[model samples]
Target: MEQNKEMTAQESLQLISESFNKSRKDILRGSAKYFMLWGALLTVTSLAIYLLWHFTGKPQWNFLWFAMPAIGYPLAALMGKYDEALPQNEVSKMLTGVWRVFGAFAITLSAIAVFLVPMHVTLIIVIIMGLAECMSGVLLKNWPIIIGGFLLGVGGAVFAMLVKNDAQLLIFTLGGVLLLITGLVMKLQYK
Candidate 1:
């Protein structure tokens, strides 16, 4: 009887450990929603900007990029509400904090870009996004995210070096495509 009790206790402990690990995985997987949303938004906006500038040659079209922050903030707030309702673990809390800081930095950089060097806005934004993505991946232990971040960084560098003047639209379009593909792959893999 004592041996049976011991075995049962061991089994119970094992089950509890497995359950905790699974919960963590679930929280990590939930991140895919944000990735997909941003991916789609970037892809569509980049393409639209590219087409508009390429055909019409209007600099004002660049202002459309602001739509990202406008849309992203509300969506992030909703997601944060949902997250607040859930019982988050330490890892989840840390991940949230990391992203919050990233958002703040992005906003600050954007404001500076608007006031100072508006022409390099796309490259600056992409590089910042790449760093954020890489940091998130490191924190979450997600390889796809890390790879995606590197791609964004490389794309930004290429854009900065190769494209000058209004032709930078190509870089934005390419970055958008890379983001979209990365998000889709992450969603499918994590789901």
Candidate 2:
């Protein structure tokens, strides 16, 4: 009877381990695609903002930043609809929570920066985004993502501070590149 209990416990542990592994794979696969999508969108939007603002000498071009989510969210939703359904798992829930918080915080800060407070909004957002990426990488145990996030979060922050005027938009371009690279790496590894 005691041996039976031990076997049952061991079997349960094995089942849990298998579930974690399976869910991690599914989540990482989906997330890799999202990283690529957002990365490309960010890169293109940042460049467009930089050009329009630089040539026109109008800060209002910054408003284009909002277009990112306008496009990204719908595409992401569509992609989610197609992805194989993932099982409920701790890692997935944690990752979802992290991104949700980030989205809310970013939206709030962007609104305040645009409407009420004129601050170094670009750098602040980049830093926060980097930290979030790094956190995601840590959760996924992906080295490229971790490194990319560190570079974007810390190095990008420093670079943004040093660069002057409209040049700051280039930081987003760099961030997008990093994210793109990370996504490619993940895709290759996971595939």
Candidate 3:
């Protein structure tokens, strides 16, 4: 007990420095899987959008898909993983809020698709999903979110290709509306 009390300030500082350095390294090492996961999601979305749009006979915005997921899964999964590696108490909680919002949006989108109830409103929802994905990427400092956004944009355009000119207008309109809603909702919960 006496020896513990006699510990020097310099020694404590050194210990802290060492611990901080170790944590920093740990964060970097653990981030890879998350980044890759994000990247893969972006890449898949990009490809899906490209196919859908191209199949619909619209070649105008399809080119964006090629650049969609340059990062891929491993890089994407590592995104917040880096933060997790740090001595993050506050930041982690905040980031998880974003993740939670994202998860909600995901569920909503999945429900929409699974129900097979396509509507003008549904198109709007899809757009919202796209924007949510993009925002998530930005918040997390993940490139995959940007890629996801681009893919969503492409996907929206692709939807236009599937229908006639008159119907295209409706789909595009709702898609934009829903995207706006999605973005807003996601932004509200943004940490």
User: Top TM-score: which candidate number?
Assistant: 2
Worst window of 10 by summed lDDT in candidate 1: 1-10
- Once fitted onto the true fold, the runs of candidate 2 whose alpha carbons sit more than 4 angstroms away are 1-23
List pairs with backbone clashes in candidate 2.
none
Error of 2 at 120 (Å): 1.0
lDDT of 3: 0.49
The lDDT of model 1 is 0.69
TM-score of each: 0.77, 0.83, 0.41
lDDT of 3 at 41: 52
lDDT tens per residue, model 3, 144-187: 44675657656865785576433443443333343343334333
TM-score of candidate 3 versus the correct structure, residues matched by position: 0.41
Candidate number with greatest lDDT = 2
lDDT of 1 by residue, 1-191 (tens): 24455557788899789888777667656665666666677778777877887789786787887787799779877886777444667756775676577667766776777777555666676677777667766766778778877877776777777876567766656655665665566556545
Angstrom error at residue 9, model 2: 14
Which lDDT value does model 1 have at 17?
Answer: 97
Kindly report the root-mean-square deviation of model 3 from the true structure over all alpha carbons.
10.6
Clashes of each: 0, 0, 22
- Kindly list the per-residue Cα lDDT of model 2 for residues 1-191, writing each as its tens digit: 24355557788899789867766776666667777888899899999999999999998998888888899899989988987785646766776777778777877899899899988887888889899889888987887788888888898889888997789999889888877887787777665
